[model samples]
Target: MTERYSRQERFTPIGPGGQAQLANKHVFIVGAGALGCANAEMLTRAGVGKITIIDRDYIEWSNLGRQQLYTENDAASLKTKASAAEQRLRAMNSEIKVQGIAQEFEAETAEALVDGADFLIDGTDNFQTRFVINDVAAKIKVPWVYGGCLKSYGIVLPIVPGTTPCLHCLIDHLPQEGSTCDTVGIIGPAVQMTAAYQSAECLKFLTGHSMTVEMVYADVWGREYSSINISGLLNPECPSCSRDAVFPYLKKEKGLKTAMLCGRNTVQVRPDQLSTLSLSDLSSHLENVTDRMKENAELLMFHVEDVRFVVFKDGRTLIHGTENVEEAKKLYQKYIGA
Candidate 1:
């Protein structure tokens, strides 16, 4: 409401009237990685009232190249992306109410974290999380923007509940295979451009501006851009958007429990539900097992053999130097006492 947003308000599409609408809107941003970080910052600066950011990983030195919200100190301290992003974004705009959730977006907690939001944005790196977001958005009738990037290429699609084609309609099943950011490497510009387009679409929807909605695909490195005609995919037989199928992504499924986090050479293990541990207490206990244990209130970092385990207070851990979940879990139980 001050001169801080005068430039944005001066725009014909987002005058003072549309700015007010943005002030009342609430958006849930899933995944605080490359795409999430960029989009969250833009949305906050654009005057979106409240934003809830969720991510389970911590900042690493490698993240600094593309995840701009993090600092070297944050990476050194192993700050969770959500916590670090909240600190940086609040400093960017105090009027924007931002909540950082240092937790993974899974079936058990996905709905609770995403519920009641005016819109959802996909910044996640993996298909498992995206499917969860897509299912929830379709079931609740909330609009969502899905954006992804890898190796100087990215895609953005906006789904307006009953109007457009839901994400699942574009595919019969999850991609059995795909190259990750770690495998192919991502350019920072691709992430920024994709996030900017996604944020712009979000603003358009919130401001009652009717724009041509289409799936945007861009290869910034190759200088190629194309959009597919998906308007016809919104069929009445569509399981998610039209037929009202029960979102199965909200249900638990068995798969590879190991994941090599994008942008880092770390693998995460999805442990069975367990009681939470205080970082300090776990650190103290770990000292008896390993002489290289280090702990703060938020995280515990220790080295055992060639791998390093960075465990957060919420029971999620990142095991560096290997992509073996079984081995990671073994290391977690050995040092952190399960």
Candidate 2:
């Protein structure tokens, strides 16, 4: 028995054989927020060989409460969540390999990110991204664990390509009306519960143990818990899985109008389709903003009162200090152009 994993290997559910299986397996986790950070930490300590953390947004003060891997300095620095999580995980288990990709996992990027991953775990906050993950997991025949948390409640589902109903099939059973994490507010316990569930489900699959494909739902405050069998709920005609239709979210190529980033008071504004931008040239034309502009090879940033914006060469601007999409777009027009 490995000394580091002696206690874990002693567990009857995952003995020596299971420990061997976990080593060197690649698990791609999308989103490095609360659940993502928690899951990555748990799996890393458990000695999962390789983990790839993908996240597009940066860290903020609001994230420190629930996300375990980040520090106050990370939030203040606006550090990319994936990169920060990777740094922390590597330090936790230097023997394991961890990679962080600081970019959105959209249709255009999903295949490359999910390819060769033994398990996919959803820590993303949006349904659109979840749909893209579903398509990729199905196409690749890799099992994925879907987890979502809002306020004090959370849900977990272990999805097997041919054996279990996919995420799309669970759409019909979703709550029709409810407060989101942003409005009602998500507590730390809910996030941890969901992450714990997701990590356990991933371990089951990786260790060759029979996985429970039920939808495990929990409410920490209400003290409510239930598990619903999803086998019968499988949508026979679901386009994503049953018929294997082309993925719409995967057809993505530029043209993002207004995107509200997760957990940050920010929004992204861009042209219908990206056009190459010259940051140095654009900087010369701006006025009334802070004289001190932060510029690097990849992006240019300047602050105007409450709002700070970063511009990329790909005609994309992330407007910080605001959640309103329209305000972000207006700022983009005023500064980055129409």
Residue-wise C-alpha lDDT for candidate 1, range 1-338, written one tens digit per residue: 48988999899998999999999999999999989999999999998999999999888788899888999999888788989999999999999899999888887777777777999999999887888898889888889998988899899999876788888878767786557776788999999989988999989989988645688999998999999868888767666667657677788756334566765678886555634768887777767767887777777888878988888776777889886667876776776555
Candidate RMSDs in Å, in order, are: 2.2, 2.8
- Candidate 2: the clashing residue pairs are 107-250, 255-272
TM-score, structure 2 vs. true:
0.89
Question: 192-304, model 2: which lDDT tens digit per residue?
Answer: 99999999989998999988968899999999999988799777777667765554545666544777765567788877665789988888876556785777655677888
The ten-residue window of minimal lDDT in model 1 covers 254-263
* lDDT for 165 (candidate 2): 92
